[model samples]
Target: MTASARPWVLALGLLTALRLVAAMMLPPAPDEAYYWIWGRALALSYYDHPPMVALWTAAGSGLLGDTALGLRLLGPLSVAVASVLLARAGNALFPASGAGYWAAALLNGTLLFSAGSVLMTPDTPLLVFWCAALWAWVQAHLRQDGRWWLVFGVLAGCALLSKYTAAFLGLGVLIWMIAAPRARHWFRDWRLWAGGILAVVVFSPVLVWNAQHDWVSLVKQGGRAGSVGTGSALRYLGELIGGQIGLATPIIFVLCVAGIAVACRRFWRGDAAAGLLAAATIPAALVFLWQSTGSRVQGNWPAILYPSACLAAAGYLSPRWHRWRRWGISVGLVLTAMVLLQAALAPLPLPRRSDPTLARLGGWQDFANRVEELRLERGASFVAAEEYGLASELALHLPRGTPVIALGDRWDLFNLPEPPPGGRGLLIRSTRRGEAEPLWPQSEPAGEVSRRREGIEAERYRIYNVTVIGDGPRKVALPSRR
Candidate 1:
């Protein structure tokens, strides 16, 4: 209601509106659609990530229905949460200051936060939970209020439930405690122990699910960060740093790294406020930095660091680099605007082999329409896709309750029951980077589906009529899909 709060209000409103429009106008990314389908049948955990994203999506679609707007509702909603929490976090880190405002600005201006506001990925909820926990941690440490510890525990657990990467949040807290001499009492504090117990309890469902499934999720996610390759360590590290730069706008990204270094120094000098910010980011950032040595890390893998990175950058970046801040904001806003337009209109003409965003946007509508026609014309009993992403995309768009299945390991994410043995299907293969051979031996290419963008061919899919010869029903209909 105050004048100062107006900027935050405006930022939140503009972001929410842009994200909502983008979410509705642009089709869901294949991964976003996969998450939405995952939401349809909510589970404690999933093959990909934990159940928090499922919970977030289910809440949105359950109330608003299965439309894109409904599926992506929570993403925009979280923007408001992230905005307010980052503000509070900024104030907590530096009392009676503009740190909060700058933090919120630095965060909202970047594609990391803007694109995430509509994408509905695990990072969506994880961002919300991470910022919330950071705020609570600052309050608990600064006020020495034991009650805030419980809040931190709950938020931390929720972050874990959102993604396994949040384990670094726990590590950060421990590092902060050990590194900060005065904070040693937390080790013996009963409130801390109670909070720890609460976090374990909150995260128990994921543990139970993994236990039932032979700990597959743990092994898979853990194995990703498993072995460190001695070769290409520098190259991987260089990419990780460059990727973070792109994720955060270039100038802001540089400031974020420097801010973290500054905060780490303050932590060593016994600054609790700086320590809270450093603890939230430094440990997680380092883990991913180390991860880059072993694997080809994605550009956004270190997105978890942005909450604290934004806050730290705000407090540190604003003191200097006024012109650089303008450049960063301009670049971020321009890039975001271009993306929104791309999502809405697919105006960009980039190579499909390189940047696939616009290409992904173009082909789906045509693919969906053609696939439906194939089902009716060819009398195909089921829709089979070569990859999990294709299966989910076709499944989500083709029919309300169509029997769409992925050929290989992609089937694990779906909650649908196994088919009743024998069936005939139309196999849709997007020849971008997949194998030419069909998973079923009894299948051959029947025809092709060409999807175009701006009157130019963007994707070519080979359609195959596949049959599983068996004693079951040779003429079975597709399952009544949900």
Candidate 2:
């Protein structure tokens, strides 16, 4: 191997191994368990996200065992893959002053990647391939190699299969092809056409799934960034800013903003590489900014931009800005260290209001154990949870070979076949915003139980005895999310 490649390769390998250990130690987040459910019922895709997370979870579970560690093994490893890809992409684009290491280090320090690594959500798969696409673009465009175009096509398509946010990659590609004289020729190139076709082929499964399901998934996701009613827009924007600032950290965020400004200037000055990176990232970030003005946007909605944004930042963060760069890296490292220590040792004790991680991931195992006892004592043949997140947690933490089904949403479409139809099952409904109000109005309330963490009620479930209808027990229609 080349001298330069060795350090990166070694660092990445060690980081991957350490992250894998953390993945094994930490409890599965609610979303992780929910996706685990998707993995077991493997489909082309799902109602919420594409099939990539499900595919990863299924592979990890198969390779390991059906445990928390097994289900989440890929989550942290994906971070390492993304970091390595970011390093390579940075080198390909900036190619100065160890840009590769700086870019990877900067990205790793971002909470978006660090916390995301253990979460095992849709973002993990999206990030790994997003970096791949970024590197391939740099290789294909900046290096003037046609072969990497095909690789970019595959990775970009895979990014889409991971989440719909990848459409922004296409938008950037379109803008670059239109705005950059050097990129314009690609419109007539056979390689470009071939790459486009390949992307469509890779994404065909999602399209086919939508066709079969009346395009429900597409419609649901498409409408998400619309208006957030009237007064909620400012509140939503504030939340979005706070979330992004937290995830990226203030120093790195400032660097990214400055980098984008510098890239815009350089692109107008006929710098093709700068234009490529800016066009590929800026539009996606702006979309989130604009969406935040109208609707509540998730913090990670624009994460696809970071892979290129980090490299863009590396382009201008040079010896001239050494003090600023050092400060950013130093503060970022401290933040990262604190987060890693918390994950590795234990979460800090805080009030339930301030401790979402504790309130959510902490009490689930105990909650499952108590509910299992309730099922046995009440002679309930099966267990059911009101939401996919709750259902997935119960299914994962409950006794092995047990079935915990989701009671609402399109869950009727994927609920596990545990006690079969007509069986008397114990339904677990939380007291969230009066959730138990209309729960099983037709059935009798058999008993109730509480799940607590540090003497605070993390979750409370009212158990009801209900016969599984032929179609499954009736549940109130879940409110439309979008």
Candidate 3:
């Protein structure tokens, strides 16, 4: 390793170590628990997403057991790898000005990455493989070697397995090739076609799984494309912009916007490297931008763009805007630190409703234990929840091998075992929502519990002792055993 790269290595190592410690200290978010259940029940694909996250979670938890650190073991480690790959890509693309180090630093400084690194999600693996693919693409260009195409194909395939958003990477590559005169000749390369085939091969299991399940996963995700109408377009657009700004942290967001603008200008000026980065960014960004007009665009959906965009931003800001770059990193790091502290300690006195950290992570373990106590008191055969997240959280905290069934249509599509008919269950639902009357034939309010953190109530749940009738309202044929 070069002398200059050593400091970055040490810095990233320290950050990753801190993240791992935080992972152990922090509670698992509801979605993390939900995905943990996915890890327990391995599948080629799931109702909501591909199986990569499940695989990642399973591997981690298998090694560490089902603790928070176990569930999140790979997340920080993957980000560390991603940072190195991104830095290498930046260095190869822009040799001078230490743009590589800046790219890695800026990425780690982002709230989206720094704070998110402690929680395991589909985005974790998605970001890692996405950066790996970008690095492979850079190597392919630098070496003019067909073998790198195969590596790119594998990485891209892994990215696709991680999330459907990675399809944009392929689209970005196509756009880059078409727009760059020098890259156009690669159209005749047989290896390029082979690489495309390889990606499809790697992703084929998901396709087969979807086919077996009547295309449920594809149809469910594809349904997000429909427009909700222009009446709320401006509202959703503003939210999308605001969400990105907050998640990216304001100054880093501004830097990314400026960098993208610079990259676009350079693309027109025949800078293929700049074109590559811009192409990787713009297509996905435009889709999200347009989607915001018709529907709610999730803040994390744009995460895939950051790997290449951060590199571009680093190249654009280095030397000329060094002061601004430092300021952006400082602000992002500060914001990230605050978020991490909040998630770990809940020291801030923000209202439970206003603090997402409290809303998502706080009191779940205690709440689960309370529900378990109620289940025993009521002699219930199983504990059930109307919400999937609640169900998964309960599963994570309840006694090992306890039955925690999620009562909803989405659960019918999962490979999970169905709740036994004619058995009594403790049904938990949000107090704010009306009762699910049709779900229980004989029902009586058993108890209530409040999910609280730091003396503030995040939410309240009403529990009912209900005798299940037949298969209940949300039932379907039990999914075939895998």
Candidate 4:
């Protein structure tokens, strides 16, 4: 609001705008391309997530003419909006002190700024709406205003539509209710109920879509989680913890831990909202805890909790000690520098464009030429991979609706009920096999396909041609009836 504040906000905005410009031009991440297909098709649900990611990409493509910039424009734009809302929400939530600025700064420098809002993923949009919704709820609670609740309703609805992960917010809210007595008083408020109904209304499309498709969305998510062996829960948990450290940065994580401890001790006993904020992150934490038991967990799965993490940190650190204020800026700068360095080297190994290591590890565009070659040779009709990661990359390289499939991963592209009947299919695998080999071989092969062993850094993919048998005894019916 002040001139000093205006410049800080503007600087953040500028930084975001600059990053987005890069994102706009940067090649689509494999996952983004896969989701882009969903957007092109305009489905209610896909094998991976609700349709919101698809809808956002489709809308961007339609409006911006479907270039790489079109695909990623929404990334920075959402983060910018989220930054604004987070500042506003922090101010409203903690009006007396100047802690809100720190909250904004902390979020700007953390993983949320680096990944979600900048990556153009479904989580970016969800985070935007999630922050807005929380801000709206704070406004409504503080003022007892129906208008804020209405806005909150819409935001919650949109958040739900963006990703089912939004449901974790409900868990957070419920935890807040149980832990903070003051929040319990709002139970009889009509606005709260109305807001709930509105959220359901806004998120209804995903539910309806899921129902029509036999809840395949649920099945897909469950399968993904289960794919990680339950025995590796500790490794998964360790990765999650390490990821949080990287994502939140040590400074903010420490602040959040202090904030939570303070809230639990000084605030939770009396203030319900603070308690609610602390409670909201539990579901995600618990899910990670459960997931850790099975397989290596991704650090980003718990990304949704960072807002609360930051909020809690802000609350705890601000009141306890203003002495370390200068240190905060120094830490933020160091973390920001690290992130920028990573981004600068994003197109690693120089102009080679074929880093098999990065490609196998989620940087498929490193072999853009190979992907392009396959698309050109195969006529871009049917491309499938044994891994979703590869399939996702193909989705980006191949033309829209090229019918990319995931074989060995229990995600059968050909399993769809009405996928183009029989087309030439290109298979990219780590193992060598004729078309007759079972997609999911019971054991890891003696070694990966010979192509993967090639000296070409990006030539890890081995291609094979196969004809998809349609409507035979062996054919798995696509879920058209569902």
Candidate 5:
């Protein structure tokens, strides 16, 4: 590695450092909890996502145990890999000395760093695999090397295993080939189609699992997007663009589009690599814009676009912006500072800023512990929940025999073996009720047990301890306490 190569090393190091910083600071989201649960189970597929994320989660847990840092270690490690791949792909596209390094650096400062890099989720792993696949595809395209097609096949397969979102890449690439006269030869290549078969093989398990579950995952995700209409659609698109501004600075986003225009000319002149960046963005943006017409969209739905955008920005800026290197550095620093400040302000209160469904994240484990004490004192049979997310998290931490049951539709995430024995169950809610009627006539509330404070700090519904006084063998009596 020489002078130009040193920047690649520095960029990689910076990405890894940032990942470490975020892993140490950021808390896990509900999705992380769900995936962590998958890790604990070590299943082939999850109800919501494929097993790749579960593998990442398990790796984190195996190394760090079930702590925040443990859950996030793999996520940041993934960002490091994505950064390296981005650098290599950029180098392949441009003739500049350190173009790849600059491309990776530009990616480092965007919201991609925060969401895909810092916050560990299924997408984090998928992004890494996707970047790697794209890099391999570019190499194969440029060198006409048949063997790289097999590499692309394996990576594409892994990307699909990571997330269903990788379909966009195939679609985008296909369109790019059909539209470009010079690259039309890709259709005649046997290895290209062989790669598609490889992706199918890697993704088949999840496909089978979804089939077994009646494709519930697809229905759930589709319903989520379509459920929001008109007003929310407009709002979602606005936020989508807003998120893009934060993730890939407004200036960089603008420059990337211009870069795509310039890259298109090169592609027309048979520079196959130039089309890769534009192919990723143009089609994804079109789809995003189309979806925005009816349903609200998530900003990160098209997160796959970030890598290409980075490449585009590098292309647009290298010629003119590189001339003013000092000015570019100053501007880049200012933009990064502003974005970090915004992310900090955006989620200042942690989980509260994320999702309210989760029990006020603060002191939740303490609450879980208190419930445990009462359950043990009274020798409770099982723990029932009004919500699934909370029930799932509590189940993870609670004593093994203490079954957590979901009383509502949200509990669909958990697969219960059967109802608690004798139709009698212990209800867990955040309220004051000593005893109440159970769902079955045979079951009734026995006594109340719970922890209460001055006010609900995080809008966690009042947790209640209701004893179902019904016909069943008395394991232990609820203590006579207030």
Candidate 6:
């Protein structure tokens, strides 16, 4: 590596090492455990997301076993690669002002990316492939080479496999091609059409999987588009903006907004690079902004916009903004470090409801152990929960070969083994977020367990002794032993 590249590599390597340590230190969140179960099953797609996260988890755990480090191994590694690719893309897009290194640093410093790097989730793979696609597109535009389009296509396909939200990226690219005068000529390029075809071809597995499953996955995710807010639209919009500010960190969010405004001005002045960045971000930003006016938009839903947005922010030329950029990174890193520490060790004396890390990641192992003791005492054949997250967590922490059943309709979509008819099991129901009723007719309160982290109770669950009286349609299922 060149002398200049060495610092970037070393810095990224150190950050990755710290993330891996955090991954190993903290227990898997319920969502992480759910995705880990997906990895165990290895489906073409899933009821919630496409198969990329499953594939990534499977690869990580296959090599490192079912440990937290194993399941989350790729998250940090992928983010490191993403940071490098984003740096290159920034440099290629704006050569002056060292926007490349600043982009990389700014991205790493963000709470969304920093905290996300240690968690095995759909967003993990999506962010990496998103950066890769941006890099490929930048190379293609700068070199005016059609071959890079093919690379962009593959990365775009991978991003789609990671999450359905990736469709917006493709939409943004189309807008750029149509709106930017310099890029309009690509409409006549055969390779451009070929690249589009290649993306669809690569995404065919998900289509086939959905086709076989009655397009259930597509229907489920697509339904979110039609949801309207029950409360005032302004309330939801405020929440959405507040969430982004907190997730991005206030100073960084300010930088991004300022940079986007600058890019918008340059775009109308016929600057192709600025237009490309603006086009890539505006479509998704507007969609989410509109969605917030109707329904609650997830803070992370706009994650795809950050690669180009950060690049734009890094490229913004202003003495005052440059000073703010430095402070932004410093403050962001401090906030990120605090979150990591809180997740790993609940040092702060916050209430369980107030501390998100405690609510999601705390006390799972202890909770599983207590549930297992109850199961054995009741002579139950399997353990069951009405929630998928609870069931998946039980599956991860319960003894090997223990049958953990998710008593829900979604479990029917999985290829796991059906629960035995006329069997007895322990049913767990959370008092805080209970959604489903008991499936079995014969159920009685057996015990109650409180999930606690650092002496603070996060949740309370009631355990029931349930005996299946008949082979009803609501019967749960369990995965076969690996």
Each candidate's clash count: 1, 0, 0, 11, 18, 0
Per-candidate Cα RMSD to the true structure, in Å, reads: 2.8, 3.7, 2.5, 5.5, 6.2, 1.6
Model 5: per-residue Cα lDDT over 1-482, one tens digit each: 77868766885676578557656544455466556666766655666667898898788878887766787788777777777888888887776666777767666655555445666677888888888888888888778786787788889889888877787778877987887676788788898888888888988887887888788776776576456475766776787778777556665566666667777777777766677777877887887777776776676677777778778767655466654433433455465544343343333443434533223234445556767776677666666665445555566556556666545443344443435344334556544222344332343445544322222344333434444443332222111101
Tell me the TM-score of model 4: 0.80
Best-performing candidate as measured by TM-score: 6
Best by lDDT: 6
Report the lDDT tens digits of candidate 3 across residue range 1-482: 98898988998999899999999989999898889888887888988899999999888988998899999999999899999999999998889667889988888888788888889989989989999999999888878887888899999999999999899989988999999997887788988878889899999889999999999999888888775755588999999899989998887788888888899998999988889899999999999989888999888999887778788889975466678778988888888878878878988878876788888888877777778777787788887777777777887888765676666677766666656577778778887787556355566887788888777888998878876566455632221101
- lDDT by residue (38-137, candidate 1, tens digit) is 7876778988899998888788888777667877888888877878888987876777666787777778778888776777889988888888888888
- Sort every candidate by lDDT, greatest first: 6, 3, 1, 2, 5, 4
Candidate 4 lDDT over 1-482, as tens digits, reads 78657877887777787676666645566677666656656655665677778777877777786566677777777777787777777777777665666676777667545544656677888888888887886777678676776788888889888887788776676666666677776677777778788988988877787787677777777676667674555666777787787676666666766776776665436876676566756667777777677776676667777676667667566545554444654575565654444443443443225432234323444454455565576574565565555565665655444466554433433224434556655656643234355463231222223222123343344566655654322322211100
Report the C-alpha displacement of residue 163, candidate 1, in angstroms: 0.3
Q: Write the per-residue lDDT of candidate 2 for residues 74-142, one digit (tens) a residue.
A: 877767777877787777676656787777877776778766676688998898888888888888887
Clashing pairs in 1: 401-481
Q: Count backbone overlaps in model 6.
A: 0
lDDT winner, 3 or 4: 3
Question: Which stretches of model 1 miss by more than 4 angstroms?
Answer: 228-231, 433-436, 469-482
Instruction: Between candidates 2 and 4, name the one with more favorable lDDT.
Output: 2
Question: Model 6 Cα displacement at 146 (Å)?
Answer: 0.7
| Per-candidate local distance difference test | 0.77, 0.75, 0.84, 0.63, 0.65, 0.86
Runs off by more than 4 Å, candidate 3? 229-231, 435-438, 474-482
How do all models score by TM-score?
0.93, 0.92, 0.95, 0.80, 0.80, 0.97
Cα error of candidate 4 at position 450, Å: 11
User: Candidate 2: where is the Cα deviation over 4 Å?
Assistant: 1-10, 340-347, 415-419, 439-441, 454-456, 470-482
